[model samples]
Target: MKMSNLAVDICGVKLKNPIIAASGTFGFGEAFTSYMDISRIGAITVTGITLEPRLGNPPPRIAETPSGILNSVGLQNPGINYFLDAELPELRKYDTAIIVNINGNTIDEYCSLARILDSHPIDLIELNISCPNVKEGGLAFGAHPDTVYEVTKAVKANTKKPLIVKLTPNTSDIRETAKAAVEAGCDGLSLINTLLGMAIDIKKRRPILANITGGLSGPAIKPIALRMVWEVAQVVDVPIVGMGGIMDGTDAVEFLLAGATGIGVGTANLVDPTACVDILDELKDYMIENKIEDIRDLIGALRI
Candidate 1:
């Protein structure tokens, strides 16, 4: 017997399963098609986009820490038009849902971006409030409850599509941010974005990343992400998309135990673009071995 039925709903969008490839690492959701049947996983969130194309931050934008990598990619992307004209149509060939992750430097930026996708055939609009909020005098919009409320409110009011708020791990109270977004009208929350961290070069006596500090991701952040997911789960009823250094089915299972309805595989994709398929395979085996009839039964079912 197999236990492959792990379908879960996030903001009314039903995924074939709860495991998904996170943005940034998945490259517009088309790059991994040859490695595996793209439709086998849940939904795919494309890399973050902006109103216009971006070259991203300068080189040395990535640094390898002990168990993770620090990146300041600056959300480099080909802009929304490219996605609309090129990526979306091809991706629509599959039955899976394609979500565009949008980032902005200002409130109007968030609203304007939402308006762009308002009538588009996308499944959801994920506001990247984790982008440092200059509107809050350079504080990350996802860092504070107030900023989360305001940004989410603006986007929610502007767009009719399901709005998902991607939260940052830098905050002291992720649960507070989760509640704030929901209060501000967010339909769901994807959390545990890269932790703020840095790496160094002893020979240069300077930081390794050009940005000095960057988002830390990969297996190193899994434990903390799980704890945060569980904590946020206790506070909010909205669906949670848990991610951070998730590299295998076991990692995905850990996130489910922490109350995450869906799991995003980020750095693991970079480690092996095929990790999603392998993780899916492992998940099947684990379910059957445990005598679990359906994977959803494992979600948020940890007994302690």
Candidate 2:
């Protein structure tokens, strides 16, 4: 299917394609530049940056499961300052849009980052509210509608750049949370930020990951991610960046049909460093075979 259109405008930022490298999987967008042309990607969501540098969790941070993996990296990063100073410059050379994923132990830290990044040249700021909220008794801000609204509102008050609130699937009703973010003034939403999961080593009689619990991601959670995306899409008016375990073009198409304006490629990168570009090709092929002239036609095209 010789196509001419693949560009998508996500929350005011233009992207060449609909596939974005999910945060945490792609580290600052520098590591994958060696394997593929980073410019070919739609956008790159950098690793989760914190207020200060962190070493992350101890060894055995990753554990392979049936069709997915458990990761307890604990948001280890070089801090936002280093990222703005060191990483941003290098990534800016790429043609794709730059979206930074940020986390904080407190609402103050989140607002601080937002205020600072608002003055930068970045395209968007994705709030990683999946992290534990120390002030709220260790619950993730994204899990509760009130916290989600408050945090989203506070961050939005400080930033002029487009804000994309990344939601957790651990909530009882993801739709309510999505609505809260939209009400709080988020420009877009990214759903299914790794389901809570764990694995055990029988012989050792202990948990496989040192953190005891971790985020499960890969093809195993694609179905759940799709459902959440569909649910949120039905309730909210903001764009949804759906992600979970998208590995191929067919998987990417499924997300678009589920009402995702943009697709996030996560574990696929670990499986194949060139997965982003490869999936873009597959998406084009799928569109061609399906007689789809424009990729945007696939968004929310699912029939009941």
Candidate 3:
């Protein structure tokens, strides 16, 4: 079958394939270009960007679990201005869609970043609502439906580009936040951000991560990610980008079957720089073996 059959669209943004390099792992797509052809993958969601540059957490911010890793990277980036001026121009030369992942400490900061990116040539805006809300007593904006709606609506109003809200899994009900985002005018949703977890340094008699806790990701979280994506897909009418512990082509297929219109490869990238394209190739092979004509046929095709 032709590779063109792998094409898929997310929130009106066309991707060559359903495989997207998940945020924070791909590092703006430039780092992987040396390992493989970056253009072969679908879209690229750069590292989480803030209004200002961050020094990130102190040392020992990452620890390896049985099948995954815990990370408290603290949203370190060169800030949006540096990204637009230094990174985005080079990223534009590539053939994949550019999804800028933006984070803010307050609602107004989110809105301001949206307005600033509105005039840029980026293909999509992914709101990283997992960031702590400074104005709301240090709670993540995505933890509650009300705050999710408030931030989604505020950011939506400030930008004309298609907005994709990345939902945090550290909530009581993931479905509610998904519904809240769509109701507030979000064009699409990405589910199953890292689950709250930590590692203890048994020898050191202390927590491994400096923050005492971090986001857990890897094959260990795939089951939870798939369940959340399937649940959210049942309730929301918008497109869903499913990510978490996706380490290979089979993992990507599972997410697609679970109702992800787009598959996000996260921890897998850190394991292998060429993981995105490799997963895309494996997905194409799966389609050929299954005689699937189009990649869209796999979306929500799970046997219930």
Best by lDDT: 2
lDDT of 2 by residue, 98-121 (tens): 999988888999999999898898
Candidate 3 deviant stretches above 4 angstroms: 1-4, 131-139
In angstroms, how far off is 103's CA in candidate 2? 0.5
TM-score (C-alpha, index-matched) for candidate 3: 0.97
What lDDT, from 0 to 1, does candidate 2 have? 0.89
lDDT per residue as tens, model 1, 1-304: 5435778888999888887778888987778888888888788889988888878888788887777988888888998899899988988897787778888878888788899999899998888877531233223688899989998998899999999899998888888989999999998899878888888899999988877788889988988999999999899989899998888889888888888888888888888978877888887778878788776687788787
lDDT, candidate 3, equals 0.88
Instruction: State residue 1's C-alpha deviation in candidate 1, in Å.
Output: 2.9
45: Cα error in model 1, Å: 0.7
CA deviation > 4 Å runs, candidate 1: 132-139
Reference-based lDDT, residue 120, model 1? 90
The parts of candidate 2 lying over 4 Å away from their true place are 132-139
Ranking by TM-score: 2, 3, 1
**Candidate 3, run of 10 with poorest lDDT:** 131-140
Model 3, 115-173: lDDT tens digits are 99999999999998874312231237889999999999999999999999999888999
TM-score of 2: 0.97
Instruction: Report, for every candidate in turn, its global Cα lDDT versus the true structure.
Output: 0.84, 0.89, 0.88
